[model samples]
Target: MDFRDHLRKIIHVDMDAFYASVEQLDDPSLKGKALAVGGSSKRGVVAAASYEARKYGVKSAMSGRQAARLCPHLIFVRPRFERYKEISQQIRKIFFEYTDLVEPLSLDEAYLDVTVNKFNFPSATILAREIREKIKAKTGLNASAGISINKFIAKVASDINKPNGQKTIPPEDVIDFLEQLDIRKFYGVGKVTQDKMYRLGIFTGADLKLKTLDYLQEHFGKSGLHYYNVVRGIHLSEVKTTRIRKSLGAERTFSENISSEIYMLEKLEDIAEEVERRLKNSRVAGKTITLKLKYSDFSVQTRSKTLKLFIASKALIMEETKALLYQEPIKDSIRLLGISLSNLNTEQPKSVKKPSIPKEEQLKLPF
Candidate 1:
């Protein structure tokens, strides 16, 4: 096979401290200061924090009180989810301008399969730089991008030069790059796995590569295959437009089965809140809300409501779910209560209108 013909070009883009950076961009005073965005209440966690705050040891998922203790000068602000959602949509629109093969990992990160693109650029490195420049000019925010032959390396390269930077790894240098990488830096190697690898004398990619496939498979199970392929710069995963959902459910397994109307209402409130959070995090809106119940003797029944439009918010989900839950009779003691949202919108790609190619040019390969 031709070397260039078998190669793939992928890019990964990630925003720097996305939510906190947006806050600083909108307010000049917040720049160059230790700032965090989330509730300051004792029960709340930090959703996002600026790099300045990170220097003081503040991090996301830590309790608000813990962050305050770590950085006495920390400035806490509430999350404006609506504003963040609007900005996310703007960034997504920019990705579409380059290629239709975008796979969003979250609100702040995405992967683009740009082996073929609308701009007719010869280098993925150049395309990445252009995309970063466009984002900065349009949003007044900084972004990091990585370009490489596959998604794994591209994702890692993006982080190599962070906070308004781009890095590219040509195919020839991929092996040397992987060999020197720390085992902890590998995608699936979390803290627990890192410790296990250390005990086994696998501290770097070189060490991991030296192990036999059988050895790795016996030690790490199915993940060994992933490790072997990625370390060797070989990946066959495709950027999928749609993925099947694993599960859909809503339930209230009550502490005690009660027949009182007031008691059931309180239980339903908790269930609705959980369902709403899951929908938003998954970026899915569902048209169907299902209510489930179990009797004291273990008999189960379900009722469902279908809406004309998809719903994603807590209030709307609760209203519809409560209505469905009440539709069924509550004659026996209820042991379990549940709610589920289905018929989610995964968002598919639109058809790209390819530019017409001349007969002579079409005969020769584009890349």
Candidate 2:
């Protein structure tokens, strides 16, 4: 394919240290401090940590005690999911104002196909700058953006200059960009895969591009196709907007096993709140509520109730979640508890059917 023909205007926007940044943004006192949001107890893990804490070798998913060992002065704060959700909505509104082709990767990141946008911006680079400016202006938060010919390059470009910065890669520069990138930096190639590739003498994009499809497939299975095309800078995945929630669930592994009903019920309330937030965020109403429990011995059991009517309210969800929790007798100490909402309604207004035209036939027609 001609480089120009394959050229696209893709933008990847990612919020820096999303949860931790939000906390610092709201409270000036927390700025430049080593902060973590989550449980402070020995059992709790860091949900997010500020850059200062990262300098001290602190990281998310590390146990609170471990983080303290790494950075003894780290401050711990409980997560405020509702507040984060509210800010996410605000940022999303800003994205929609520029383009309808926004695909959210998470509450804090998105990919936008701005080849044709509402603002009539002359260039994607300019549009990215404008969007970043708008986000910071409206939310008092920093966002990084990358503009490139495709999603792969755009995602990489976004992280090159983080913490409220933007970068763009023109179509002509795609090959040069990928050639010098470290094997570990390639999209979708995580630590384990990178180590395997290193042993195979595939240490760079240039190295990867030299491998035959047959060789890659023989080694990596289905993912080999992905690695093959990405090295050649060919991506056909569209910015998909029609996402359906397959499951809405919350789970927590306790630091210590608990056999008390009262304590377990309290934890269920927190889980129910998370389930409700996710359900409401997706605007999904569900019919089934499931309760999952894991015993101290690592055995698991589940019980669920299908409601007659779909519900999204927090109170109603908690009521059903709590009822399911007690429905089964606990034979041993519980180490984990979970709540899941499923049987979704994919019947949104835009989800309605439309006439389709084959790509080959449509291409034969002229504007």
Candidate with the greatest TM-score versus the true structure: 2
Q: Which consecutive 10 residues in model 2 have the weakest lDDT in total?
A: 358-367
lDDT by residue (tens digit), candidate 1, 1-367:
2223335678899999999999998889999999999836343568999999999888897767789988988999878888888888888899888888887887888888777787767678888888888888888889999988777888899999998998988877778899999998898999999999999999999999999889999999999988887788877565554445633656655555688867887888888888888887787888888878777766878888889998888799778877776686687988778888888776555544333334443214322
> Which runs in model 2 stand beyond 4 Å of their true positions?
1-4, 253-256, 259-335, 341-367
Best prediction by lDDT: 2
Could you tell me which residue pairs clash in candidate 1?
250-338, 250-339, 251-338, 251-339, 252-337
> What is the clash count for each candidate, in the order shown?
5, 0
Off by over 4 Å in 1: 1-6, 243-367
> What's the CA error at residue 332 for candidate 1, in Å?
29
